[model samples]
Target chain A: MTLIETILSVGFVAQALRVTVPYALAALGGTLAERAGVVSLALEGMLLFGAFTATLGSALGGPALGALCGIVGGLLVAAVYELIVVRWRADQVVCAIAINLLVLGLTRTLLVLVWGSASSSPRVPGLGSTGTWAFVAAAAVLALALSELVRRTPWGLRLRAAGERPDALASLGVDVERVRWGAVLASGALAGLGGAWLALDVGGFSDAMSSGRGYIALAAVVSGKWRPLGATAACLLFGVAGALELNLQAEATSLPRELVQMLPYVVTLIAVSSVARGARAPSALGQPLG
Target chain B: MSWDRGDSGASASSSHGGAWTALYVTLVALLVALLAASLLVIAFDESPARVFALVVAHTLGEPYGAGQALFRATTLVFTGLSVALAHRAGLFNVGAEGQLVAGSFACAALGAALPAGTPAVLALPAVLLAAAAAGGAVGAIPGVLRARFGAHEVITTIMLNFVVSGAVLFVARTWLFAPETIHTRAVVPGATIPALGLGGSAVSWAAVLALACALGVTWLLTRSRFGFELRAVGQNPDAARAGGVNVGRMTVIAMAAAGALAGLAGSGTVLGYKHYFEKGLGADAGFTGIAVALLARGNPLAVLPAALLFALLAEGGLAAGARVPREIVDVMLAVIVIVLAVAAAETRRVRASAGDGA
Candidate 1:
């Protein structure tokens, strides 16, 4: 099949839609966090924890229970992240990496302790078609909602002020830290839901299964210019790239598979470098209050 | 754009005899990590004390264990220094993993191309230099991109890692890799660094090279005019530019130097130990190096002790696998980083407040 035809095929389109769920959700969450000036590097760890807990929760009950547990898992990681980055004023980049590493190690340890296997959990009841479709709709809706929230809401104004001008917010008798704290927890919950959906789609959790999706989501946020709907759209574009990669790997004998695997990241690099030229980050992003 | 660069060692080394305070903070951080991990151990119905004993006995009490830890530490020292230099230049380089692999590939490619009868004196330096150059080239791509195009180094460096991974795999499969293995052919004897690991261990003279590099980086960052410019840019780019420093040039040079240090990590595993390039050899060294650099607080000279500590923990993690999950060591590493960051920030706050009082 020609490249266009292959991308337009029902299977390809469906796969793209399916894969885009995690990226979109995470990207939206990242948009929210970055818009509030938090680095949100721990989004990766939050996703992993959400996946593991969702799988574990599924084993205990059903998809609904698992979904709740996933959000809790994400919140737990966020709380720790906020404590370090906000309360203690630790370096955001370092703290984010630490959170990711801790999750990687902690999950593997938990897997060994619980399942007696370090590779994967025994197959549990996944969210299946219904849950996935529901998440897809939810991601789209949340993106729109986030846009509105940032545009019209008083709390959202506080969030923007906190990121762009902390001193201004402080002078207005508002707590900048409190606004940032709210934004981070909210982002964590969104990212956790994204992770839970990932696990539910597969019916189980595997070691480091989130792989580099969290980073990819971060790229989406940057390329999307930290806007909710824009980031979600970027996620969809990446999802299409991923789908095309898989299609090419299956049909094209001349193209190397390794080259195909690098498609999304290469695309992200191009997009990010282009976007960064004129884009401005939140003024307070990654800076501790003086 | 704002970061601390983890300068715990700065105040300590500068004045008021803060070295002891820095040491105390590190010890306390380690203690905190141990205490937290011990709680997890008890939750899992294991003996923290026994696990600790196993870790000590395996990594320090036996020559084999010591040699293995040293082998790991050799690579980490190189990578830790890489991260440290980048941090000192106000850049967070996440591409050391790719840089090391690129170096290994170059080292192996040159070794395979050399005549089998080539002399050691000619082959060794050629192979080593090739490795460094390849790594530096990889490192420079991100630097150039950031300097000229306004791309963020953090994202671009990471993306380069994937690009490098794909390119390396393609090249290896076509002309380099041995049949059915993800490794390249062994280098000719002339190109191989002599091994010196104790107790049948895999370490080589790479340990000595790592130590030399540490001292060299320290000198470069402290004594050289170029180093002064780099640090000035790191502290405040606008002020440095006003002072006539080329911030862009410093950024590129610093990144290349960082890549070269990480790239030299191949000297330990590929040149000295395996005598060939292998996939997965470069994995985690960069990340673990980040942990080491943070613990060292970006002090190049202190990377030795920090890398050794991590290497010991790595070996100990495996040794304790009989009674507990070995992955706990990674958790410990993360905890150490987080705690160290908080401690460094706290110290800075205290100093800032005290200065205000003065």
Candidate 2:
């Protein structure tokens, strides 16, 4: 096949789409939380926990239950985050970092306890091809739904208010804390789903399998200017990069694998820096509510 | 608003009080972290008190353990100072990890190139300087981006980390790859730091250097004019710029300085301990430094004790790995950082309310 034909192959597109799913889902979730003014460096930890719980639940029950368990795991971490950031009013970034560390240790400990190894879990049932397609469609629907929710709905208005003008929102008798808590919880659930998609697709969990996808998702959130559709597009763009990298790895490229591996991160850095000037975060994004 | 001699005395006393308060809060946070860690131990079906005793004995009671703790603290001290220095300039330097890798790579590359019988005075300084310069250059990328493009330092630094990690691996494979192992060739004998005579421990002169650097950083931050400007920018950039301080220049300098410190950390691992550049060395130290700095409340002098505490925990974790997972130490570190963050915020809230009341 010609180079162009190879590049445009149906298999390549499918693979790219597959890669895009988790990023799109996680970025959308990040958008929800950041829109409500919560910084989420813990997305990595949340993703790992979700994957671990999903694997464990799959082993115990089935894929459906595994996904549900993943959401719960994410929610548990999110609750701790809320307690620290919203209730105690800690520095959001520091709290997020702490959460990431805590979850990492917790997941590793649990993995060793249950699986008898810290590396990878035993094979479990996964969402088959049909479920994968369903998830992709659901992600697309979520992107559109969230975009509408943020732009057209009153709840969206309140969430934006909680992020940008918490005092004003509080003065209007809307509980800013409640709005933020809801957003954070929903965000966790979505991120958990994304992570579950990763594990179920692979039929098992590996140590550090999420592997900085959470940070990349955050980059997408920034590059997309905190908009749902924009973030999804950014995720697709990264997914394409990832797919290209994989393609290159298969071919006999003279470039070292390490340099090729760096392509996505370099692209992310450039994209984030370029779009940073155009993007404006919420006015009170990282501030504790007074 | 008054700039009088009498006000200077009052201000000094107030600052002292603030330091004391930070110390007290940090102690309380440590206590809370230990309590949480104890609960984790209980969940593991072990007696928390017994585990705690074992950890303490393994970390501090034995001479070899004490030396290992000090060795670990030597590296943490540099990275902790790196984070603390950047924090003073209002920059969250998440790239310390990358900078450290760059430094270690530089040290290994340069030390390997040195002639076998070169003098220690010449070879040692060359490798150290090379590492610091490389790390500073890597660090300056995010600094420049932030200063010139208004890019958020946090994002840029984090992105740079992956880039650095990948680049380091590529370079190590292409230029410094050892045929049999995943690490580079050992440094020349002149380049290797001599171990301190500490009961067969791997402790080296890096510990002394770390302490000296800590003292140096404390003086630089507290007594120097540059430090005053850096702190001003951290407190309020607009005010600092309005007062004729070059905020942009200071940002770049602070980041570079922070990166250089992290590079020194890499040097401690390579020159003082490993004597060769390995792929995974000094990776976790960079992240752990954040916890150390937070616990220290960004005080350079306080970093020593904070790093020592973390080092003890790390050593203790390894020693007690059979009974309790070493990851529990990481949980404790995270808990401490979170508690300190909350405590710091609470103090700020109280101070603000008091100002309003006044």
Candidate 3:
């Protein structure tokens, strides 16, 4: 309420950065797929499966091994989605929803059968154990590198062309499916990293840890016009909103946390509506490639 | 989007028979998966035979279990109809969860505020109408925004789901919550639907009402003039606009109607089953509606059976207990939906090829 109190709130803002790290990572992944002409709605399930695998791997193996397992798990799931939607020309949206549902069941089943727990795993080696800020720094650097790669690389141009006009890309002798496949795989990997960060970096696995962050990442991807740097900025803004809400709740602040919590979603929607208007999405974002 | 089913070996006069075959195959495949899943449980040093038997005995083998299944189906019917209706207008109504929750809040508030002296006939419709208005308004927001600004409906609807959930949760805690319990005060008896006592379980006439609503929507879509226009707009908006159909108006109307269906679901929860609104009551209603609509291929009549099947699986999953693991139902549902999506995609491709040839 006072100037000093408002200045002290900066600490909570810093705290929110911790929450934003995973979201930024996930949104970055979504940005890749969307840029490549695929609406990867399976991010939610991919995140969940990745988290479960990472938790299981760390519980059985080490945290490093768990992270690798998560990446592999994400790739495997993405492969299935790509095969059905891209290769077989299935409805991409429904395929993504199916992946979400299938993984929800499979992951919950795995939790009960393997870990004998419903929501979480035993505390294993975690990113927090190494250093809390380490994961955040790594993510930011990855975001910057990927952003540059997307804008500068020949491969990025081909990927963009594939999304823009697969038929035209095919006419130019570029295998559109192959390019899209690579993008899908990359998207999965990034989402997996986000999931691993949530489970290993943040805390042990929790059933709803991903919550709707995967969906929010979709919002971020749209709001950012499928650009990596733009998405990173959007994710940070959302993260700050989340951080503010948590801190408000913590200090028993009289202001309604729910209303504050609504801010991120509202902002994301507005950002998406504004950004998506002029910016062209992947011409065939939701369409299955023949 | 009519299918000939000519690829099947059925005669022209018997083409309707091919539909029956597809339906049968889908059901059989689902059952086989359930069987295989249950067998896996047995392989895990558990008694597969016992678990399978228990699931059947509990879900289908008992009278009470069937009643509960119907109750679950009643809620899903509204959601299924909601999604199906939107699909008919080529709109994805992903905000059903939010609309449902909003409806629940309104139903709760109205149910609480109404006097005990009001007649049941007058009060029941009032509560339902309040819910429909609330839910329909929520559904219309994305539709109206999209119509006016060309803003994408999918993202806005999804975002709204969270907003509605959070808003309702806040309302529940601050305004509608009873002094004692965390939930809202009980609705006046006049506002509640009378439940039928069957096999020691209370069966809400809501199922009958749901059936009537489903039938009403089906007839409206297939037989009514507006239904023809909505379908035309759904199939090809540009073409529909060329033909004098107001694409934007149809989108809003269809979405609003869909929202009313979902709202009815929430109202049913308060008026038929629970007397008060609770958090997490929606769980996965909106998401599940996607699967339901896909399974039905946007056919309102087909949605009834599709929703019923899903409801049975959900209810049966719980009754099946530790052996089946409730998640198994989700697995079956996911597979079924994916299969349907693939089928629909294939159908579209084949139709496109035919058009090209023409």
Candidate 4:
């Protein structure tokens, strides 16, 4: 087949959509948390927890139940993060880093205990093709809803206020802490869902399976300037790059596989640098709330 | 911006009653982390107290175990110092992993390529210096970007990590690939740092090098003119710039210094232990350095003890792997960091309030 024809194949499009789903969801989640003035570096940890729990739950119950379990797992970690970061006002970046490490270790240990392996879990029932499509649809809806929530809704205004001017929100009798807590929890849930998609698509969990997608999502957050739709577009751009890599690999092209594998990250680095000047973060990003 | 209002105050008061408070907070956090870790042990049907006793005995009680712990601490000290130095200069060096990779690769390449019969003294220092230079070059990429473009160091550093990892893999496969093996060729004997005779353990003189580096960093930060400017930039870049301390130059220098330290960590692991460039070697040491630095609260001297504590956990984790999953130690480390961060925040809040009252 010609190169153009190969690139335009339906299989490539499906694969690109699948790759885009996790990045889009996670980036949106990061946007939510950061928009509320909290750094969400724990997206990586949350993704792992979600993937592990989803796999376990699918093995025990069903795919739907597994997804729910994923959210719960993420919430558990988020609760600890909120306690440390929000209540005690710890360094957000430090707490996020700790959470990532904790989740990585915790999940690996749990995998060994439950599945008798430290690297991966047994294959479980996954979301079938139809269910996968449903998930994609759900993600799209989530992006739209989140954009509206951040831009139009009263809650969105309050959330932005919490991030931008917490003191002002506090003086007006709105609990900035509570708003931030909600945003953080919501971010965890979304990141967990992203992770669930990863496991459910593969029907199992692998060590560091999320790899650096969480960081990529963070990059998308920056490149998209912390807007939901913009972040989604950035994720799709990354997804296209990922799809192109797969196509190149399949075509047995002369380009080295390692270089192809590096495409998405290299693109992200370049995009982030170029856009760094224009991407303004929340006013209180990384700040401990008083 | 208001969040940092508490930092200056806390730093000022820390001089008076700060040491004790910091120690107390660290102790409490360590206890809390241990307790939380014990709960996980209980879930595994293991007695936490017994497991703790075994871990302590296996890691610190025996000579060989002590040597192993010290060996691990040797590497942690370098990476920890890398993070601490950067932190003092108001830069978070999250790319230590990449820097370490570059350094080790350079060390392995130089050590292998050198004339086989070179003198130990000449070969050793040459390999180490090359490693540091390579690491510093890699680190300066993000530093220059941040200084010139106002890009966030955290994001740039993280992105560079992937870039470095990929670049290293590509280079290894194309140029340095050892026939039939994933790792590069082993280093010459003259280049390898001889292991100190410590109960026949793998512990080497590299531990002394780590100590010397720690002392050097302590002296640099405390007594040097550059150190003062770096700290000034960290505390307040605008004020430092106004006071004629070239903030941009200091940022680049601090990041290079941080990278060089991490590079030493990588080379120390390769020349002092592995003797070759292997994929995934010393991969997580950079992240562990973050834990070490946080526990040390950016104090170069304090990094020694913090590194030792973490090294103990690492050694204990391996010893206890039969009865418990080794990752539990990681969970404990994370828990300790979280607790410490919270405690540190509280201390800052109290100090800030006191300053307000005054």
Candidate 5:
């Protein structure tokens, strides 16, 4: 019950980071895509694909090359996603869900075919143990800068305008589609790195390694009001909840561990509901610019 | 993601034929995909002819396989009904898995604590009722939040699924099932529904019960005043409200009803098959229910056939000697679902554009 004890508890910090890393990265990706006016729901699918590809890449090559492969893989998926939503003008929500299903199966099937194992954990040069927390910090900083750039820079302003009102932006001579494409690809890369973090840092490439964190990240982005710093903080909060659950279980707390585990999700629900009315998403976020 | 400003207006003035046509195109697209998938299977050394034959053979192979499929379909039918019903009200109940799990947990508790001398007939219904109530309550949470607070049901529903599963796993492991067994205790014989004797495979009377429930729901959806309100709300909430429908209440009630149906499905699994609530019993029934609703085009009557189709594919895929990697079925299903969703969205877009043109 002591404040010092609570802060020092291994469960608190570990659970917080364990939950925060993937979510923070994914939400950052979501912030980028949404900021550019595209609803990048493919974040979840991309996350899974990232995990699968990174593991596969590391297994075949090494960690660095594998991470590169994951980036490529993710961008490739984003391109396909762009084709569907951008070219065909498909409903982004459905397209994103389909993409999730597609990646989920494709990765699992491909893994089976190639690695002959559903759970593919590759031995590769991961971020050294000492650098684990460093990676998380760097990710948070990068996301903050990227989000700030999207808001402050001329390029960021144009991208925001393209998402807000395409006719106005197009009249200004900006190709809305091109801007969205770049944003989406960037989104994929960030989401892919998030996946890489999961594979390399979180237990190596289990089938359900992402475990719906992609969706959770989406919630984080929404709950964070689609701001980089807000989303990161939200991710950290959920991470703390998750890490706390583990430690609570370790301490053999009388409160059911399951209920404790439910905290993050419950928090997400409460946060989303509370903020939904006040949150101002980009006006034209899901609206495809002509 | 490109957002299409598909006229989501609630007007029957737009040609209804467009919706039908969209459905038609979707069906054709699905059939084409199936044909292509079948050919792919054939290319893998199994004759296309033999594949269909085996599907038929394994599905209707014996009284047992057929019975099992029917039983499986019964559970799916209710879950599918859960999804379809909610869709009619424009609420996506993706947490059917959670609702179902929660219902099963409640049902197990109800069955275990029932008085020793209770009659089988009364006991069964009582257990089911308890399940429905519990599941319905859980379903109502998101419904209430969405109605009252405008919370996105998608996020809440997905999160709820995890919450339910995690909670159920812990409770089942620690409290309900003796830790020794690691699952809930068996339902008392009086609480169990007797299965129809089909050689080898046991078909629960629950199948007939589920079929009846499906018919009743279909009737309620198509013939009742509530159905009209539900459709109006789903098709256009703003319009429904202007027309005097309490859209919020309708959403909440619809979710509760859908949850009840899903709860019944979960109870069927426990009361008829396992007689105990086990971890992972609901599996992906909740999510699969979405595909079922879509495949059935949100028709309560059609959910039966769609559920049966999925059950057949699932059972057939796993049957020894099928020669197909079961995941292929998942791929086929996914393809069908995406294509259908696209077709639906496209039809909506085309009509909207035409209206805008006018």
Candidate 6:
């Protein structure tokens, strides 16, 4: 089939939706956090931790318990983050980088200690036949739900105020810190769901499996201008790039695999750097509140 | 060296106590990191005190270990200074790994192409300049993108890393490899850096060059008018632009300079140690620099001690890993970074409550 025809084909659309699951879920969570003025650099770490716990929990029970365990794992990371960045008021970007490194090392160590392998764990009974279709549907629902809730709810109004001007929230007797905490934790839970989906899809956990999806999700949040719907769509754009790369890899062309592997990042860079004119970030993003 | 990245004057945490505060924060962070690390070891059924002692002994107590620590610190010093310089201009250059790759590739490629048995005088400077130019060009990419296209330096630099690595990989695999190996052909003996004769270790004249660069960077950042404007840009780009400073130009120049510094770190691995450009030659040399630069509080001169400390832990931690896991050392390093950030915040709070600089 021609490239255009292939892109419009049902098979390609299904492949694209499957590829976009992690990015869509993580980006939606990121939008919520960035809208509340947190940079959410810990998304990558949370995803890794959540994936790990999901695998571990699956080994103990099944996908149902595994999902709960994954979220709790993500919340564990969020608790530490809150302590460092919010409670102690450290530089958000700095702390986020530190926390990411810590997670990378800790997860590797845990894998070695628990599974006797530093690279990957043994297979476990995880999310079986339904596959990423479940997460794809869930992410779409959450994205639209978040869009409406932010537009209509009082909590969403307070979230916007916290991001745009925490001082305004404070003047109105709203606990800005509480709102930030909630936003960060909520972001963590959603990212955790992404992680669980990832582990369940593979039926096991691998070292650095989340790779840079957390970061890609951050790009989606920025390019989407911190709106849930916009961010989800941006993630779908990345998914399109992934699907195209995969299709090209499977074709008869002699394109280099290394170059093919680089397609998504190239697309992301161009997309992010190209439209800097209209993208406005939350004012208090990455700043430590007084 | 300021960490005051447009904090809206609400928390000038990095600037409160100057040298004393930096010293206090470093020590406190070390203590906290050690205590936390010890707790981790105890939970894993290992003795923290023994692990600490073993690490120190392996890294500092013996001549060979000392040489290894200094060897590792050599690359880190270059990269630490690289990160610290850009940081002083309020940009985080996370692509040091790629920049180093470019430099080493250029350095090796040029060195191999030199005339057989060429004189060191003409050969060395030409090869070194090639390294710096290649690295600087790679580094300038993110700078140019951010300056002209308004890309976030952090993201652009990271994306550039994967792009550069892939490009280099394709090039190396296609034409640059010596045979079936990952490295290029060995450079001529004239291009090799003289070893320092520390018990046959890889430590070489690059150590001396690292020190020289640090001294040069310290002077450049403090004495030059360039340094003044760069610091101004870092502290507040808006104010600096208001005061007639070219913020975008400074940002680009700062990133390029930082990339050059990181690129020069390849000298130790290529000319001094392997005599060829190997894939993954500068392992963790780029990322570890971030920790080193942060530990140095963005100060060019202070990077020396901070790099030394990290090198000891890394080398010593490997030695200690016979009984204790080496990843624990990574965890400790991360804790140090987090604690130092918290200390910066606390310092600002103390100064605020004290009615002046505390």
Q: Docking quality tier of candidate 3?
A: medium
Docking class of 5: acceptable
Give the TM-score comparing model 3 with the true structure, all chains together. Answer: 0.92
| Native contact fraction, candidates in order | 0.80, 0.74, 0.60, 0.77, 0.53, 0.65
Of 1 and 2, the candidate ranking higher by DockQ: 1
Clashes of 5: 4
What is candidate 4's lDDT per residue for B111-147, written digit by digit as tens? Answer: 9999999999899989999889988988888888778
TM-score of each: 0.96, 0.95, 0.92, 0.96, 0.89, 0.95
RMSD of each: 2.0, 3.6, 3.8, 2.0, 3.6, 2.2
What is the DockQ score of candidate 4, to 2 decimals? Answer: 0.64
Off by over 4 Å in 1: B1-17
Compared with the true structure, what per-residue lDDT tens digits does model 6 show for residues B1-358? 2244665233324544477877877889889888977887786688888888888887778777888888889989989998888888888877888898889889999999999889999889988888988889989988988889887877777777778777887788788898879889999888889888786767889888899999999899889999988888887899999999999999889999999998898998899888999877785677788889988877778899999999888888789778766887778888998888887778767767887645
Here, model 3's chain A TM-score works out at 0.91
User: Interface RMSD for every prediction, one decimal?
Assistant: 2.1, 5.1, 3.2, 2.6, 3.6, 1.9
lDDT of 2 at B75: 88
**Ten-residue stretch with the least lDDT total in model 5 chain B:** B1-10
Q: Name every residue pair that clashes in candidate 3.
A: none
Between candidates 1 and 6, the one scoring higher on lDDT is 1
- DockQ numbers for every candidate? 0.69, 0.54, 0.52, 0.64, 0.49, 0.65
Please identify which of the two predictions, 3 or 5, would achieve the higher TM-score against the true structure.
3
lDDT of each: 0.86, 0.84, 0.77, 0.86, 0.76, 0.84
B53 Cα displacement, candidate 5 (Å): 6.1
Answer with 5 or 6, whichever has the higher TM-score: 6
